[model samples]
Target: MSGFPPAQIIPPQVLLGAYAQGVFPMADQGELTWFSPLMRGVIPLDEKFHVPHGLKRSLKRRPFEVKWNSNFRATMQGCADRERTWIDATILESYCLLHRLGYAHSVECHDADGLQGGLYGVALGKAFFGESMFSRKTDASKVALVALVERLREKGFLLLDTQWLTEHLQRFGGEEIPREDYQRRLKVALGKQDGTFHPPALAPGV
Candidate 1:
């Protein structure tokens, strides 16, 4: 996707304000750039969300222990562990601050081998803007996604912003809509009551 001019630093307030306006930042060539795609990718929070048949079987098997906000920094690191990634030191440090402020969250999968897969995102009002996810084991990240959707639904969240659609995300009913339509939906989500990321109903390892 296209982006604005590079920025060396991104403050927490500026980052949150950008997301609230349907914009997000990424690092390109070691500089932070902002983007608001013409076609936005969003995963439906309702029944339209699909859990693949094989993943459902894996879920029943419960291959990894699911946890929320246990190790958020680790989760972000996992997402940035790719050969090529947009998550730079500035992005990492900024989001970690958001996590500490209770605005960012992670859904993690762990086994005896330690952390295997997970996802992280920013939560504002009733919307959750998914940043990235990673998997070190088969179906680990997918299972974490399932857990995330379940938690969002349970918490009364309305929008699941995926930034852009990918084939992997399409398997779970992720769709692309024109920017205008996306902004409308985003407004509704932001106008609603804020959704709690960690409700009392969830324990340490849920």
Candidate 2:
């Protein structure tokens, strides 16, 4: 991380600043590395948004109960539990601090198996910088994502930043924008006064 500032434990305010500037940190060799992808992945919070038919069917079946910020730390840990991950101890601790400040939130999907899947992210103004997600049961994470988008849309959010493009994200109309274009969009999103990661209530029980 020669070109970047040295990794000190990131304070919540600084973390929010980084997100507002269109960058985020992931641990590399136990040190935080800041990333600003040249092509940024973002899901449109507009008419372009679409849920796949299969996922819609799953949604209809109501396989998981959706909740927001009810288990933030646990959701972060779940996302970090896979064989390889960027959500190291420092990253986890940093985000937990943000959650306490109301700038970070998790959307969770729970079934009889406990927390089946979920995702976490940082919110600034009208932008949601989606950090990571995980699923222990089939389609659990997807369900959580749908719930999240609905909440964001209902709250008049303008941006859903995914950081990088992936096939999984593409199914929901996620697209890559040039860094400059993303920055422009980010600027507009951050200019808005109201944005929130917390949903008004836990989603209806599955």
Find the candidate with the highest lDDT and give its number: 1
* lDDT computed for candidate 1: 0.85
For model 1, residues 124-201, the per-residue Cα lDDT tens digits are 878889999999999989999999888888878889999999999999999999989999998887784343223223
Q: Candidate 1: where are CA atoms >4 Å away?
A: 1-9, 192-206
How does model 2 score by TM-score? 0.89
lDDT of 2 at 86: 85
Colliding pairs, model 2: none
